[model samples]
Target: MAETQKEILVRYLQSAREALLWKLDGLGEYDVRRPITPTGTNLLGLVKHVASVELGYFVSCFGRELPVPLPWLEDDAEINADMWATPDESREDIVGLYHLSWEASGRTFDELELESEGEVPWWRPGQRTVTLQQLLVHMIAETNRHAGHADIVRETIDGAAGLRAGVSNLPDEGFDWPSYVDRVESAARTFRASDG
Candidate 1:
């Protein structure tokens, strides 16, 4: 059976979301919150920012009202609140909120036609309208880019690698662990030497 364009788009969006969330699997709150880059991009913060942008584009832009008020948007003083998780926000709370945002965004996408258009209030007044298709593509690109960051961040944090939980298909138990590490370390040293 041929997959519809909508199905493909939804699948890609969901895949990206899963990859981003997978980055947090088997990690502690402190590790997830620790800033990985000079820009302070932590795992939880990336998840939070993705959730905020997804809600804005898929729900707010489509005129769907948010179920709960976002104090960050209401209070102009803390404009950057959407970009980072606050101290009061726990790992579970932030993850749950992100899942909720995903559900809301998915619902809006499901109900609206690809041709349907809406205005982004934050955009310049006269040029605010965009089609649902455009937003979906934009979001897929945005989410995938962040998912890549999550992959690198996760690897740096705990040596956890790969896009999804089982995407990297390795043997179940017969593999030798020390040999794997030696090979990886040798490759790293060779690359560094070549660069120097």
Candidate 2:
């Protein structure tokens, strides 16, 4: 049996969404909100950013309104405000908002055909127009890119790395943890020496 185009797109989109959310497991509020990178990328912030993107592309772009207020996403908010969780914003709040966002986006997906057209107000006027198919593909790519970022952020915090929990997402190497670290370090040193 052949899966429909919408089914395929939805599968990929859901995979990315779950992967992003899973990165928050087994962590405290500090870990979820800690600024792992210089740019202030955190687990909660990633979820918030994805939620905002979903609202803009899936709901707002289709002549609909976002169901909730996102101050960081508003026009007058500070730049990059979506990239970090605020002091007053708890982990639960951001996660709940993301879940609600998923519900709103899912409705949009169900109600619109692939050929349905919409506009992205934030984009350059000429290029703002998009179809449901285009937004689906664009968002899949965007979410997957951020999932990669989440993967690295998780690894940095606690050495957790994989596509998902149950799968053997990496090559089955016989090397122990210490040797793996040494092998990687040696490769970096070798490359540095070659560059000298």
TM-score of every prediction relative to native:
0.82, 0.92
Q: Which window of 10 residues has the lowest lDDT sum in candidate 2?
A: 166-175
lDDT for residue 49 in candidate 1, whole number 0-100: 81
- Where does the lowest 10-residue lDDT sum fall in candidate 1? 168-177
- Candidate 2: RMSD to truth: 1.7
In candidate 2, position 129 carries an lDDT of 94
Provide the RMSD of all predictions against the true structure, rounded to 1 decimal.
3.6, 1.7
Q: Which candidate is the best by TM-score?
A: 2
**Cα lDDT tens digits for candidate 2, 3-111:** 8898899899999999999999999889989999888898889999998898889999998988998899888999999987898988888888889888998999899
* Deviation (Å) of 162 in candidate 1: 0.4
lDDT of 1 by residue, 46-131 (tens): 88888878888888898889866666666564766766678898888778878998899879877988889977888797878998
